[model samples]
Target chain A: MKRKTDVAGEAQSEGGLAFHPLDQFQVQPLFGHGPIEWYTITNVTLWLALAAVAIIFVFVVGSSARKMIPTRLQSVGEVAYSFVHNMVEDVAGHDGAKYFPLIMTLFVFILFANMLGLLPGSFTPTTHIAVTAVLGFGVFLFVTLLGLYKHGLHFLGLFWMSDAPLVLRPIIAVIEVISYFVRPVSHSIRLAGNIMAGHAVMKVFAAFAPMILISGIGVLVTPVSILAITAIYALEVLVAFIQAYVFTILTCVYLKDALHPGH
Target chain B: MTTTTTTTEAAAEVAHETAKAGMPQLDFSTFPNQIFWLVVTLLVIYFVLSRIALPRIGGVLAQRAGAITSDLSAAEELKQKAIAAEKAYNDALVKARAEAAKIVAEAKTGIQQDLAVATAKADAEIAAKSAESEKAISEIRAGAVEAVKEVAQNTAKELVAALGGSDDAKAVAAAVSARLKG
Candidate 1:
């Protein structure tokens, strides 16, 4: 008794967005009553929200009872803190400590979000270009403003080194400017692409889990697939931390360049 | 040319209609969407983490690292103490062994002195006993020789007195005695 079009699969989802292979990255608009049109919220927002909440909870509870003798949770918090602190110091030096709050927050939030997304039914916020771009642009702007504020017109030296010879200055400047503009694109794409690809692979593998579970040969594959899943899960966890670390470290490097721009 | 233009126009119109029908009006091109989310994220990160959560975590982490470092330093100090004690023990053992050898040498020297004194005393006693025995034997032989000479002298005197009444008897006695003695 179904409709003729439904049987033929001619119809689509009510949203009208096609079910493309990578539809998860597309932005959908949200409608509201007011003049201020609400942007449609996606699973990415929820993932980030959950990550922030978890980070807040862990830190808050961990240090609630400030004691001379710390608990295991406190030690974990300390290790995370020192790790980011040392990284900042190593990349950005003493001045980098000023941005510790930002860097650490970014690292922990992204890490938690990435790891959380690996969970079944969870969405990875970084998988979306919008989220990654925003983060990348924030860093970009912050570094740019910081550079201008710190060195004024001298910031142009980042593009064309004043110390370079006149003959090669033009070529070097062109290359430097292109590289500079490409930073945010690469940064954003690196995170988004990695997350999206990993998730897609996981999803594809997971889809086969059911089909393989039915056939007799499927039984043999169950253990292998399970092991692969487990290993992939662990790798995702590592990737989460590494990507976050890479992002933070890159930010630190940018901040360093901003603080002292030249060659 | 006119037919081609007309056909192109019709095709464009149909394509537009199909596109309008197929896709929803998703405003992904707008800047407000990105800006709004960015601001929200910034506010969330700044306030929630910086104001509330970060401080707590920072404090906890600081305390934990401090405790760890202190413990490590304390362990290092203890290890140094242990090493120093071991060195001191070894030194004392070496000193004790040297002291023991010195004591043994001193005892050996004292024993050697005692042995020398004992040997000297025994040698002197033996020489004294030998000299005393030689004196005793010489005295005993002198006494025996003196007694034999006295007995021979007495027998000759008695034989001379008993056998000889004249010169002829003296000569015959002399001859008999010589023959018997010989």
Candidate 2:
């Protein structure tokens, strides 16, 4: 078993008073205490499964009736449906609507997972680079494959911009190809970093709350810490939804490029 | 100083272990599990959304659009019918007015013909009465002339007898006839 010396060092540095803010992100085996195997059901697995179940309940069970005059639950289902639908169609054009189901699934899963992480003691799967990398790379692979299948070798034209001057054309194409390859890295990191930062900041502020009882001047610091936690917590809620939206729209934009690869 | 060095070594050992257990997200060991579960979850969600939820919602939207389109077409048909009915009504009114004028003209001509026939019959009756009255007046004048002749003969015979002269009936007759002829 690995010893958590950094947590101990952090405790000693803070005079053995505060908990480590990043400890919440640690993945642990949910069952037997052992090293996490590939098949071991960790907290990440549990929370991701729960997010999937929540999505099913909201989209499947909520919309099962398919009422014309929608019930509240049905309205929620319809709103999410149209939101992703319009995004896919508008960004990707009419042909892009064919991939609505995939885009909708991605959006709802990330959205629910991010929101569930805000609950006390819940694991956020989106905070893991592994999970986000799969999603980002999945989109990257799917779009690239689709473009190749649809356009054949001509799909490489997406990297070649003819609008620029002849001398700058090759230079611009190199940059475009690099950026295209870097999309999955940036895409995964953006979501994971934003979520990890927000949660970490909140934990840091929460660590300051106990200082009020520990020191003479803690009274002044406690209110400020509490206020900061409250403010950042609110911001995290917005970030959670925004990050999901950003990921889904980027997927659509990538899909548009695949369908119509040009300058 | 020896004690401080030992304490520092102990802290370093603890920090090393802690670093090993650091951010689980960066830990390579858990990546496989996270990726596995993520794939499973995404596949399941995609299946539900594509096969179940999306189709149901799409059906409702299509039904709504169809309902609206049918209603609009029905309304358009009714509007055309109303316009046709209004045109028919206007056409009937114009035809009725023309028929009424024709009847009035026919009535006036019939009345004029009847008046002309009545005036002609009244003029014919007046002419016949005037002719009959003229014949009667001529008959009366002839009878008076004959009576005057006979009386003149008788008076001449009486005057001749009174003067002691023979009266000749045939001569008086012949003389009277000659005087009337002249």
Candidate 3:
């Protein structure tokens, strides 16, 4: 109880624990204290750098040998390559295979970012709306442009339901257009939200882990919280992988819609 | 939500020092910075993958597929060759068996011809020897009959002298011959 009151000021308005769960999401300069300028190298930059290095190590250096029989890292690279490749080819259609590099870029970046963020004390780039919104909106714009370029004015036919009765056609088109615009928002939020929720829940449970040292309830609360933290952390690793996969597959689906924009 | 607690600049500063982390995600001030870094990261990743990584991997994958396909076709070719070789061997074997049978038949006919000639020659030799033996027996019988006639004449002369009756050799022989014939 003494420790609780002593450190409660650190947790601020959150009375129970000495730490805030959302604090992990904060952006700060990597070198020292400074305002987070657009050009400043921050923790986000550091982790992003780490993600880049990881991609290079696995994809670039790993497959450098290009052996008929692949090494472990090469095998891993090939599996990831083909997984995204097949996904694009399957979902985005045969013509969509041309965009393999773009889809692959998104998938690899998001995947690496998500996986790296699982390290202790690490910042999750995907957890931020700015980051995901960029990805989501990026896909949205790319798909829209692709549709417009390929189908021209007919691309607008995506929202037009010719099958619907003439009276309800405009209403349905309005609904479709709204849904179409919402793709980026939902696409970005889904990844960011899933990752944020899991991490926050883990932080909350982790804060309770010190209960054993502070209160009589420490005996039970502390162990349970620790166990909960472990379980959630494991779940977070899964969420990390799943979120990356979800974001990529959705990109492919949107690409498919762009390529063959009919009914 | 927690940022609402900051009623003054001092409180916000204190919050920064303390748990003011608030919804750091919602802190609009960091948006530009985050977006900037995120763009740089994405662009870096995009280039690294598209230019360096993806092509290398895709090439390796395509190369591997090509190798596997070629290997399979080679195996199929080898299998076909093996099948053809086996057929040739069987054909040769069948031809050799037929040739062996033909040689055996030719040898059997030659042996039969030789055997028939030998059998005919042996039968002719046996017939010639039988004719010669019959001629010799006839000659020996004629000589014995002459000796018996001479003995009968001598014996008839001795008996006539001893009995003081007849002494003619010709008459004795004629009478002995007539009795033997009867």
Q: Cα lDDT for residue B93, model 2? A: 99
- Candidate 2 has an fnat equal to 0.78
DockQ scores for all predicted structures:
0.16, 0.36, 0.44
Model 3 clash number: 0
- lDDT per residue for candidate 1 within B46-133, as digits (tens), equals 6776786667767655666788999999999999999999999999999999999999999999999999999999999999999999
- A93-144: candidate 1 lDDT, tens digit per residue: 8987888888887788778878887777775667767677888988999999
Ranking by lDDT: 2, 3, 1
The stretch of ten residues in a row with the least summed lDDT in candidate 2 chain B is: B15-24
Q: DockQ winner among the candidates?
A: 3
Ranking by DockQ: 3, 2, 1
Give the 10-residue window scoring lowest on summed lDDT in candidate 3 chain A. Answer: A1-10
Which of the two candidates, 1 or 3, achieves a greater TM-score against the reference? 3
Winner on lDDT (1 vs 2): 2
Ranking by TM-score: 3, 2, 1
User: Best candidate per TM-score, number?
Assistant: 3
